[model samples]
Target: MRLAWRGPTMLVTDVRGELGRGVTSTGLWFRETRYLRTMRLLVNGRAPHLCALGGQDARTLDLVYVHPELEQFGGGGSGLARSEESLASDGLPHRSIDVRVSHAVQLDGLESRYVVANRSRRVARLVIDVALDCDWADIGDTIGDREAPVRIWARAVCDGSSLELRSTHPQLRYVTHVEAPGASAHQSGVRWTLELAPRDEVVLPLRVRAIDFEDALTGEGIAAREDALARWRASHVVVDTTGHGVEPLVIAAALEDLASLPLLEGRPREWLAPQAGLPIYPALFGRDALTTGWQASCVDGGAMLDAALARLGRLQCTRDDPRIDAQPGRIPQQVRRGPRARLGDGAFAVSYADVASPLMYVISLAQLFALRGDEALIRPHLDTARRILDWAHEQAQGGFLHYHTRSSDGPEHQGWKDSGGAMVHADGSSARSPIAACEIQGYWFAAQELLALVLWMLGRRGDARALWDSARDLKRRFHRAFWMEDESFYGLGIDREGRLLRSVTSNVGHCIASGIVAQPVIERVVERMFAPDLWSGWGFRTLSSAHPAYEPLSYHCGSVWSVESTTIALGLRRFGLDRRALQLADATLALASLYPGFRVPECVGGYAKDEMPHPGAYPRADLIQAWNVSAIPGLLHAMMGFFNVAPLDLLTIDPILPTCLDRVRVKGLRVGRGVIDLDVWRDRDGRSHFDVTRREGTLHVVRQPPPESISVGIAGRVRALVEGLLPS
Candidate 1:
């Protein structure tokens, strides 16, 4: 069997086996990560077309075309695009190779059997050659680099076929360029060609020259370029190449099998529209009715969230950082820093600027761990996770996290928006050091609560109770310190002296998001947030326009963030304010429609109802922001009222779709036990019906309906109910 490993950056292929062996078919396997939509098959394959090779289409492949800027990864000049070859591509030639792997085979005692079958309308012939004229080099040691390279040389021969290939300059580079070969390979044999009829097979040979090399920076861009090359070569080493050629055909056939598997396709329709094209956000909104677009693609909100959380886990920091050595499990508060700050190279950084966010990471991870019920998945990071939490418990300064190391450099402010001027005094002036961000406190309480839940799931009764106790203390301290009695809204931040930095913004939503709000406080906070003062006609603003510092386009002052709104909506749902959450979902969808793609903008101006008919677009916004796009589907999940019935082996769908959506269908949805095609529609009379059919599991129909609005006291009980309905 062939081993495969899929990564965020690239897919690797290693061909093994000798000239003659029992022919076998190829099979492709991947862990169904949503971000990576397409499977790009290299080498010899059965299928000739890309459509047959599943995954994301070429158009939707986000990472393929990364941000051009070369941000340093390890140290000086070691960034994502910080390679010598990458520097050459800065203004130099670049090449796009569209490889079509048609077929492969192995010769067994003169019986030329098939391996990969050509599945195209016409026959295919691939001219596989390694030219030396082009600029290519073996990636070796460099800054911010990981992994090693291997070397070897081998050849393949099909007894009765003509296939020609050559490798002159064995050096490799990640960035492909178009240049004349400096030297051509001296091949003793003539050009070989293997004719492949429709669904026909062919076999090819493999070779590699993997070896370690010392670090060198021959040019200004050489070190970085070498690093990129080395990274690529490390992932593609052929660990075992002793197998006979028979496996090549088997591997090719497996890829064919994946290509033919039927996919759950979404109904195709023209979703984007031609707007004024003023900016990215508004252009997305200027199209058709917003509610209709939202209703159409509202299926599997929970699944999307689950996928994002899972993807987020993959991007977690597996490497240790020296900055937050005292508190390791903590997640970095911010992935990117403002001007001139060193962004941590590892996937997970313990500190933001200089402040540790142990509580935030712990809480997010615990919540995800509970959601998936996969303890082993998180076990690898549990040590660091525990240490982070332990450090946070010790570092709690006056009911908040403060004055702790956040980065490799040193300690800095740790908050969602730790901008220079964000931590203002109660009189609207900036605060001094050792400040406490209200959201951090919220995250603290939230983390404790989530960890408590995780402990309960893990059967640590005593530990779970203790964690709950700590969380209860945090909730009390938070309410006492952050509550603004006069304004009836929570404070945005608190100085060391514990003075409330009163600002009527969505930051209070963080409090609710932590799930520590008492019912009475929840009502008050919700009222204050949705009130006219805080809510704009478009959606809730980051900060209320009534504030003296309000700027509609302000990054953390007043602009709207889809991610923030979605999280707030989830909090509202947990608080049994489903209608309010649904309303926000509708507003968010309307706002998203104004943008270029159905995807949400990073932030948009929070124009008031009368100030502007439509929300204005922020001048600088990223079009394809990950979390922003993720939030939309999550918002839908909250609005549509989708939830797993759990241990019951059944799905309980209580549609809360707005009256505007007449019908919605989610086909080939994978859920608890197996795949199910779900169809939800609202009749003219305004009644909602949910029909679900099992596509791949033993039938388990549960007549019991889930809570239409809220799930109070329905924690683990829901799991039992769902499991009871499953076919025993």
Candidate 2:
């Protein structure tokens, strides 16, 4: 599916820019409801012949078509371009008439500008029909099993010039106004009849506006959406690929997706962070937002991460609610406000089942602070951070750092791998609740370790020491509890009764990303991660194929997630696993290239790379997810070995390029109080070189590797710290 979205509203359509009724996921949706479902454009009562369609960008689409009735082309299914194909299929071809449609998504509406030209030396008479319909089914109704309590069909009103379609649900009201200035309105659509002289063209513009009427459409940038898109593109670092194909596509797709993430209708404007993704997850998600912010931080300078933290801080749980797994200072898993969620009926309105969100929040905030060096941005969240730490301590007392579901309606598993059977044992049985997943523990350890540094810097030495104590204790315990000496990889998690899940998984490589794994086991963890059972060649599988519960198409059991591979790659790089990290990054990007528009889905089937030339589609996966979109820049950052410690006035850059990328130029890299532009390129002989073209900050740029304390032996780190080499 290709889409153009503005904030929470998105127009999902086929590659040809046509949206029709009963088409899979084709519609104009606002928030969680599908407003306009069908839009079929026809010329002279016949479908136009699509010449070319470009739907790569997220906010605009350009389609070129020829009047099928007026202009005929040869070949039924030739793989060659029609521009070069001989037009002698029936020899009944007349003058050529081309129709070019340009679609742009405004903040409050969608605009379709069509220009039809009579290129041949003959007069052309053409009739354009735009048949449209609106289905009031929400995302839940369209994508899930929940039936809308009250079905409301749209009532169309035509005034001979424009069409107004309105729907009134039991709990809400929706308005879709179509304005085609010179068109005549019909029963369910609009039409325009025109005659053009040879070499002349007519411009027809159709605008579709959807005002939900509940939360007023902000109308933000409706007048200047085109300019807004241009500015957004100019603001971020543009990666100019030097003689590369796949790398540029992946980076461009990811950046475009991120650029469309800023929300429009919901929260206060001050802390407006980007929503998760379009059509499905278009709301603020605790884990998704935090991770996305961090993942894209290498490119955006942690701007979104900081905003996400502030917004989540403002909406942090205030009191204990067992039904939603809420506790004071617990960051919510997802904040939803659809019709059903607003009524608290089906999906959770706001949940706290994500055991890793609070920890991720802390980590994100710390990373933000480290990048910006402006403590003021993160200092506001100190109290929330401390309270979250306290909550973590409280939950860890009896269970040894784990989580259990308190609400039957919430997710069974709370981590990234939250699928129902994600925590299954080797025997295919479900692991008991309060499971201490390795990634969760890793997040907790990393949070504690990072937050303590921030606290220490903020003059709260006592709390800092306490955080350090807990972090060290958790590390020791995690190593003793989760590590399997025989396999040399960490267990998935421990059951509530202290039994190991005994399933080889991707969490060990993931744990390395968290910097929680002791240095001594890095190689073993690496070895286990690359094993045939877990490494699916394209990426790391969530679960080992040897397990009885492993299914290539399953949500978490064996599906390979771009986000997971990104984390593993980052972790691999953190410990100087350059070759392995590049392998993972190359594999992930290669897999991404096989998908539509080079945008990775939420997850794909964990088939070996050799087994499938294309990515195995994960059923119902979010095609343009923020989680997977960030994987591009995240993996790039990992390969570059980019690290920022604003507090220390240090920015490290160690770039290692893969064979796929010949050269990459990054502009607009933000450091502490400064921005830098740099380039990393490989010579013709394949030797990589790094060059910083611009540096405008006091932040020291160092060409060095990651700190030894990251993956080196913990005992050695402690000894080095004692000897005053530097704090780990």
Candidate 3:
């Protein structure tokens, strides 16, 4: 079994509580570097047998182990053998023991508590040893099969109760400080010897801290770190649920995961920005952060959204650089900060890939404005938004947003599906670069329209009109160029010379959400989405299973991504396909429930439901992905269609609750300067109804699809004077 815990940093380990060994990507990582590559425990010179392993929360892990039988240790004398036999006959192993190891990994250090209990009737002598080592490898080396170029040398120094292991390389230096009370320092590691009475237990506390070579070491205890974690969790938005099965629990877990992903320091503008995931990508990613912030806006009241936009805006590229594929006004794809991330190597501090990041930034800014009518916050960023728009217009040559990476180390398919061979021709050959992906065009269209709204709201009607016209022209050309009549769906993308790639994929589903596809084409698109080759019953596969390149476990070839599923579900709802949208939502929730903590992974195998009862885990997938966790809130948005029009001071909700959910109540939902409580329930007649149980301030509530509109004040009077206000 594999387990992971992440605070500001992350630690990944296996059931034996060992780091990297034999194709396992387990390690202790900070700032995009592996600080400790090996940490294992042994009892009596042999590894213990693991009985159970799990965690109490997102930041703690526990492993239970048992010692081997005394016979396996080779009985030294006849007396020992006779005692073992006598104990076996009595149903107790005479020399057996049980060990429990609990690990609490914090932002700057790790604390491990070990409890050893002797279960036998005879006193036993045991030696406990902890092996420690570090390679100081760069995180990029671990992603592929590439080995690290630097060699690290470790020097161990024993100082009283502490054992300090300092690792040095040409590029970086760090130290791992270990403290074990009542333990002696040995040449190999710290050792503890115990002479236990029958049924006696020993408790050993070990603490490890990773410090930068240049920074001064401070003695901060585990309690202080845990208190900091508590404060961080307390600052998050709270979601209260009523009449639900696991929905509240799942939401809480997702929020905890998100809170743990915030960067410790070295972020642009020093604002709190969430990394993409743990272990592999504890770095800022533009697209992932933008989407997570957008989904979290309903609960967080646009705080994360605002911070993400500001950070991305600050890192916006200002000049063209062929090495990193940096372009003017383009948002950086990913940012790496550490001593090892240097130029001239494959790892660059800031690199560019897909053009979608800038488009996503624009879209999220519009959403933030809608959630909060804070002109002060948005007015300062209009110039940045306009610069991005200008760059986007320049890239729309021949009527579509196209991308081709100039950097040799940059990604080939520069979209959400950045894996090699993701973009392919109908014959299964890799599609040529400078490819115009269908989803990128959808994002471009959406960005233009939303930015236009932002301009119009700011009294720049002339600029807004130009943007609106550009969006219309792009939509017209998109329908003519991307629609494949023979296949009855949109092509995956267009190649360099403008020939269609002619591969059916989930990318086209994004067009529906962007409102770029015509009304007549929506039914056919929805029909294609539900086809057996596309829908895996758990979620929509990234590539159709009928495609020759399809691989169920492949990263982007034929895997189910929760983030994509959420986008497609929202599109289905936009076109009035409510049943299909709800089906997708329920399937996604079911998949999340199968994993521990109800935490959704980055992606899963695209196996058909009939072939497997549960979704298969994709090897190397990030376990705690941000956008994937955002699916819960995305599903809620689909069901309720909640949007805050802050300019009008109105909260609009057009709820279409799924049949699977009988009732739901949301409390303390923040909208603009007010908060509201909502209660929604479905009657036996299969009709859904909602009530605003509580309201504050002058924020008006608007519900759609025709009920006689009633003033809240008069409605309250009627509710108090007569039987509860009659159902619409």
**The best candidate in terms of lDDT:** 2
Sort every candidate by lDDT, greatest first. Answer: 2, 3, 1
Q: Best candidate, TM-score-wise?
A: 2
Q: Mind sharing the TM-score for model 3?
A: 0.88
Candidate 2 local Cα displacement, residue 208, angstroms: 1.0
How high is the lDDT of residue 144 in model 2? 38
Worst ten in a row by lDDT for model 3: 704-713
2 or 3, which is superior by lDDT?
A: 2
Better structure of 2 and 3 per TM-score: 2
lDDT of 3 by residue, 43-68 (tens): 87877777778888667889998875
By descending TM-score, how would the candidates be arranged? 2, 3, 1
Worst 10 residues of 2 by lDDT: 86-95
lDDT of 2 by residue, 416-455 (tens): 6887888988799998788888888889899999999888
TM-score for predicted model 2 compared with the true structure: 0.89
TM-score of each: 0.56, 0.89, 0.88
lDDT of 2: 0.77
What is every candidate's alpha-carbon RMSD to the true fold? 17.5, 4.8, 5.3
Runs of candidate 3 with Cα error greater than 4 angstroms are: 20-24, 68-96, 119-124, 144-150, 197-200, 213-232, 235-252, 267-271, 338-340, 343-348, 705-728
